[model samples]
Target: MDAELLQRFNPEEFYRHFLADGLRPDGRQLRQSRAAELRKGALGSACGSASLRLGRSSVLAGVRAELATEEALGRVEVSVELPALAGALFREKHRALGLMSFLSNTLTELLNSPAVFDPAQLAVQKEVCWMLNVHILCLNYDGNAFDLCLLAAIAALEDTRLPALMAESGEVPRLAVAAPGSELVAEARQLALLARPLPTTFAQMPGGQWVLDPCAAEESLGASVSLCLVEGRWLVFHQGGGADAGRFLEELMPLARGEMSKLTRLLEN
Candidate 1:
């Protein structure tokens, strides 16, 4: 194709035609997501951390175990931040901030729920519980920020360990501080979550093709489908743009299940 002809070519229309036949311009099937990568224990200062990537996009998550001021156990605080560098690479600071806010609120709600993780596990007994601070930073943004953030956070939780805690009855049975990673500490490591709460997102292209794990380009022109699998059931089916989306779950379920399988293998390895 010459430059003049290529200049007039229509990529969107091409995508539509290709999608009609159950294919994408990138040669992936309709239900396939981009290859995903997970790196656990990336932050040395954090109690536990993990980095995750889907194609060019990446996120890093960390867990910090802090002494609780209140008597409540299993209380979690989550924060999502996009540094100036990340904003410059992606979009304007204000726009980036808005995007982060949306993702952050959704993640906060999900993680706060018992279906995602049991907060009760953070407690030692009835006396007190550890306050878990979960932070997620955007290293890169391709398309699925929610999915990547959740995965990274979960991986970070898996990697997290606490210093041996001691309680002595002086003023009010205050927590004792033992050195981190000390053999004298009785409970340093917490077990990972047994339920693998893998979430995946899909998007519908202009041609009404439901594409799983859309990249930056596809995401620009598609409606989104985000969901998490909970004990063999789907929770939080957030689909946007069209009313017909209700029936789309028939296709989305298999794709979400496949993503769950992929994430499970990543964690296991």
Candidate 2:
């Protein structure tokens, strides 16, 4: 949906639709999604990857596995970028850089937090280890971009399989990843395992109506929150738009759980 359509939608009408059908204007059954598709190994050179299209919004996530530096070992470096060509509005170079910085900081915090991946498992040789460079490209915008990116990253990482690490010399401690036969498999072996903690997002529209995965129109109507759930708990990251956010959070709990269940099924299949 277009952002302009969202800006023009009447709050009263939107709420009326929700009340009538127990769903949103898009008729997604409150917890239902419009349809999502994921592509793995989309980028030929990347070690691991996936791309997801949630209706009109597109997210491409790539995993670059590398030996961790002393400071970054046992941690994941997740970054996001919306290049100028990716969106018509983001034509300026500075705008794209600024967005990348913002996204990197936000995701870095999540990856480092205890609620997400377990950083301790990344250790290799007691110092040098493995790190995940998760890069997200937002090729299109239609609201719910943050949630889609997070979901895509998790799914891509889940599908990723790192090869076993072997020492080349006892003195030098040189290591080799992946298996001997395939270069592709050998590259994958050098990395450590990745741990993923799931997160699901919900949006609260106007008139106290809550919806899971609100499209562009519903997102712009009022204040909304992105609730990041991990292991049956909530780790809220952002809630914007001068809305009565607390009440909305309480109301959307059940809806978020239901949507997450469906999402898990989609990825598993």
Candidate 3:
């Protein structure tokens, strides 16, 4: 039988054959991760934006700032869109909605956490402030969407610039976006992030082997775990299948830390 026919009919068998030889169909070792590419300020209209590609998975994130009342001050709202064209799984409406909700809520919580971003920075005064609306769109889905989304969000937020606040006595303050060549352009300030969080994702193959940065085919075959590191603390998310969670952490912590370090360096540069 040809390779394509075997893969189409018996993906498990095909994957097992490759694993037996200590390789993946993509020619990567079990412990290897895909290369990531990132670009900031990809959107001209938004306050900030970033485009990130992790292996074949691509995501774009944009941030827009709006004036808000005291009650909504310093709030960040996140929304994720996963269209059918991105992947076969998303072709089902329910599955796409479920995953979209999960990713949106998870990212909103992470971005709003004080350990990552300080809400106080958004405060313009006592009753006026800025609210950030962040939107993430997945252009391709090859697996590891969570990691790609989070990193894209961080990059967009870092690229964001808040306009100058204009206040008048006994009146609500407004934001001022300086025109080109205006001196007030210098007054606009970049958003300050308190911590840099990065995620390393691993897929647990059926045979009890964990593969780092699994592609779409490998992901469909097993459970997955994502470990995010922020300021010396870890946030873990696991889905489907069961294993010795503690043991998994023990074995993967070093690799995860190393991956986070590399990502941190990327952001810094």
Candidate 4:
């Protein structure tokens, strides 16, 4: 084929052509989504932890709790780390700094918001309160970091257990956490988490065909949608793809709902 003809058959065009017939480069059907595997309590040293793998991307989250040392609006803290071992993309001096900063800051802000996770569950009025610190590490970069990180963090929090505070009879009356695995600790409530905002990513091909949960190669190739769903409600709709937003709402909205349902079930199990 001539250069002009080859250019005419670009990857996006070919992908659209195949997608119209329910085919993909990775052999998935047009509406098929990648499976996610979550292993709760994976980190022994941490208070609570979970390791989640979405396709080839891996995210690990650990939840630690301690007495609040500084004044803050909420009881939860979130930090995202993309180490060099995760991918060479993370090792770039300037680029990685910017990307990590954006991810961490955005998630931290959203998590502290009242709608995502309930902070009241972590607080015991004015008497006693514990601050939860969530640390997430990207073990591998295969795209879908936003959704996978949220998945791991939520699962870890759900798996977390806090030791009940015990009153110590001393001159100062210091409070101490009950020993782990003790009867008092066993009675403490598990972290209370609300039904969450599930993230769904879609890649738009040249002919307006949409692919959900795009892989790494698909992500860098073009623009896409990063949407979040909670009980079928659209919490956030981020446009990162070249596709028409109107057409996407008209054609792919139902597909995204199906994806949200699937992800919700995955998190439940």
Candidate 3 TM-score versus the reference:
0.92
Q: TM per model?
A: 0.84, 0.76, 0.92, 0.83
Candidate ranking under lDDT, highest first, comes to 3, 1, 4, 2
Q: After superposition, how far is residue 169 of candidate 3 from its true place, in Å?
A: 11
**For model 2, how does the per-residue alpha-carbon lDDT over 159-206 read when each residue is reduced to its tens digit?**
556556665657665667745653341233333223344555556655
Error of 4 at 184 (Å): 6.5
Off by over 4 Å in 3: 167-186
Question: Clashing residue pairs in candidate 1, if any?
Answer: 166-176
Q: Give the whole-model CA lDDT for all candidates, comma-separated.
A: 0.75, 0.67, 0.86, 0.73
How many clashes does the backbone of model 3 have? 0
- Output the number of the lDDT-best candidate: 3
Question: Can you tell me which runs of candidate 4 are displaced by over 4 Å?
Answer: 1-21, 69-73, 125-127, 168-173, 180-187, 237-240
Model 3 Cα RMSD, 1 decimal: 2.5
State residue 171's C-alpha deviation in candidate 1, in Å. 8.8
Give the per-residue lDDT digits (tens) of candidate 3, residues 192-252.
8899878889998767888999898998888898888888888988899887877666887
What digit string (tens of lDDT, one per residue) describes model 1 on residues 182-268?
Answer: 444237666467576788888778877677888766766757877888678776655457737555567677767777777788876
- Please count the clashing residue pairs in each candidate, in the order shown: 1, 7, 0, 3
Best by TM-score: 3
Q: How accurate is candidate 3 locally (lDDT)?
A: 0.86
